[model samples]
Target: MVYRGPYRVRVEEKPDPRIEHPNDAVVRVARAAICGSDLHLYHGMMPDTRVGHTFGHEFIGVVEEVGSSVQNLQVGDKVMVPFNIFCGSCFFCARGLFSNCHNVNPNATAVGAIYGYSHTTGGYDGGQAEMVRVPFADVGPSVIPDWLDDEDALLMTDALATAYFGAQLAEIREGDTVAVLGAGPIGLYAARSAWLMGAGRVVVIDQLPERLEKARTFAHAETINYNEVPDVVLEMKLQTDGLGFDAVIDAVGAEADGNLVQHLTSARFKLQGGSPIALNWAIDGARKGGVISVMGAYGPMFSAVKFGDALNKGLTLRMNQCPVKRQWPRLLEHIQNGYFKPSDIVTHRIPLEHIAEAYHLFSSKLDGCIKPVIIPDAS
Candidate 1:
């Protein structure tokens, strides 16, 4: 898949990736997922999202080749590649902060390298195609367990791991009330993971009816349609006896909708990196000294946020790009115990040829599409 411009992408022939470094490996993609973060690149939200870039960060594949120094993987190994590309020997990676590895991207202070995002993320071509070149092969890609489903393995690359990490950041104590903003895949997974973290109640907030219903059935959380309430934050506070939730998760990022001024300024005019509607709601909807976990994707630009309110409430704010590989062990156990099924949110499986159509459907929220998986060789 090649990006033509915003709202325009097409399947194009590209050269198969080759080993470019001693730590590199080439993988034949079996399944790749269009992440909600990918939508930011699709809408031209991320800086330097140049034309011809392939935008997919969640993928699973079979190792086709490996570099001379590669030790952990060999040909024919089924692997789930983490979205993060890190050298594993960096100062940050040494401490398990793989997302902040300084050895991968030149702009490592902002974020470590990522596959198929854009120049801002190290300019690595993503795995949305038939093949992808993976760097730091021994450090990043994990062999998929035999019992795991292919679709499930694909989501583990990003969504499932990120959501679980968000819950961990929230520091949810036993019986804590948690509120998740947005009913997207990340929010749904955050809600589900909150239960595993011992959250007594989980509430999901969104405007769409179908997504709200999904919060009920899929995440098994209480649902609040922001459209139905006069004030969403007040509604959230009311639900918690006017004390607000113990922990709040913001899963809606730059493209969030709620305030017209915020939408026009950030998402439309590009004056800010992203709209802070969901984030502001999180601040106002959390109790004093409550924790706020941000799992949403935002750009480097400034966003208008309620910093004073957050300070006044003494909210503990924790946010970061997920270190995907770090969360796999715990998530694997959850999957093995049947506590989570990453594929449950997969509502559409589209071939690479129809990716443009798939993007349209997802961007438009058509057909109740929750998540769309790409089949590069569906033909």
Candidate 2:
């Protein structure tokens, strides 16, 4: 797929990738996902998103070729590639903070390298194609156990890891009440994982009926239709007995709805910055001294946040790009122990050829699409 322009993606043929460095590996992509973050690039909200770029950060594939320096992996190994690309020897990576690695992206001081995100994240071509070039192969790609389902492996590449990381950032205690904003894949996962982290009560708020239904059914969370409620913050406050939730998460990122003017300025006109409606709501909805975990994608520009309120309330704000490889051990155990099926959220399976249509359906929220995965060989 090639990004022709904003909202102009189409299937296009590109050259098969080759190893450019000794630490690089070429993988034959088996499955790739269109992440919510990709929509930011698709809509042209992210800067330096070139017209010919391919946008995808969640993918699982089989190793087709390995460079001389590749140590742990070999040909024919099935692997899940993380969204963040990092050099193992970097200062941040030395501290296990792989997402903040200072060596990969040209603009590393601003934003670390990420696959298929945009030029801001290192303009590496993504995995929404027949093959992809993976740098720092020994440290980034993790081999999937034979028992793990391919679709499950696909989700762990980004969505599941991100959700788990968000929950971890919240630092939920026993019997805590957690409120998650948005019912998208990550939101649903965060809501469900909150229960795993000992959240006694979980409430999910969203406008989409299907996603809210998913929150109720899949995450076992109390549903809040933000569209139906007069004041979502008031509703959340009422749910928590006028205090607010124990921990609130903002999974709805730059494109969140509710404020028409902010939407028009940030989302529509590309002025000001990304909308902080959900983040603001998370701030306002949390109880005093509650933790707020943000896993949403925001562009480099500034978004107006309720810093004064957060400061006054003494809320802990924790957020970062998920260190996907770091979460693998726990997530693997969770998957193996039947905590929750990561792939259960997949609502649509699409062929790579029809991704444009799939993107349309997903972006428009048509036909109950919760999560969509692209199969390279699907006909």
Candidate 3:
């Protein structure tokens, strides 16, 4: 897949990746996913998203080759690569902050390298193709458990992991009422994960009827169509007896609905980094001193946000590019226990050749595409 420009992506022939360094390996992609974050690149939201760039951060594959120094993996090993490209021994990685690895990205002070993202990350090609080069092979790629479904393993590379991380950041206590903004993939997973973390009630907010229904069925959470409610924040307060939710998760980033002015200024004009509507809603919809967990992707630009309101409310804000590998062990256990099934949310599986159509369907939010998996070889 090659990025032409905003809303322009197509399948293109590209050179198969090779081991460029002693620490690198090459993997034949078995499964790849179109993440909500990928839409940021598809829509020209991220800075330096170059033309001819492949746009995938969630993929699992079989190790096709390995460099001289790559010892942990061998050819034919099935692996699920974490979206974060990090060297395990870096200062941040030493503290288990793999997303901030200092050794991978030259812009390490900001965030670690990521596959198939723009030059703002590490400029590494992504795994949306038939093959991808795996850097720091021993650190980021985990061999997929034999029992794990391929579709499930693909989601763990980013979506499920990030959602699980978001829920963890919320610090949900037993019986706490949690509100999730957006009924997208991450929001859905965060809602389900909240239950595993002992949240008493989870409410998902979205304007789309299909997504709202998905929130109720897949996440097992109460649904609130913002379109139906006169005021979303007030409705949240009313649901929680006027005190507001104990915690809130802003799972909609950049492309959030509800506020036309913010959407136009941020998403349309590129005047701001990304929409802050969801973040602001999370702030106003939570109780005093309630925690806000943000898992949404935003560009590194100015976004008009309610900082003063957040500070005055004494809110605890936590966010990061998810350290995907860090959450796998617990998530794997959750999967084994049948508490979560990541594949349940997968609504479409389009081949790489039809990726343009996939992007169009997802971008338009048509055909109930909550999540779409990309099949590289299906064409």
Clashing pairs in 2: none
The deviation in Å at residue 173 for candidate 3 is 0.3
Give each model a TM-score: 0.96, 0.96, 0.96
lDDT of 3 by residue, 1-379 (tens): 9999977898889888887899999999988988877877887777899999988889999999999999899999999999999999978999999999988887547888999999889889998888999999988999998999999999999999999999999999999999998889999999999999999999999888999999999999999998787888899999999988999998887762223344345654311236677788889999998999999888643456888999999999999989999999999999999998899999999898899999889877899899999898884
Tens digits of per-residue lDDT for model 1, 171-212: 999999999988999999999999999999999998789998
Clashing pairs in 1: none
Cα lDDT, model 3, residue 125: 91
The residue ranges of model 3 lying beyond 4 angstroms of the native Cα positions read: 256-264, 267-273, 300-303
Model 2 segments beyond 4 Å from truth? Answer: 256-273, 300-303
lDDT of 2 by residue, 288-315 (tens): 9999999998864355678999999999
CA-lDDT, candidates in order: 0.88, 0.88, 0.88
Model 1 superposed RMSD (Cα): 2.4
How far off is residue 352 in model 3, in Å?
0.6
Candidate 3 versus the native: TM-score?
A: 0.96
Tally clashing residue pairs in candidate 1: 0
Backbone clash numbers for all candidates listed: 0, 0, 0
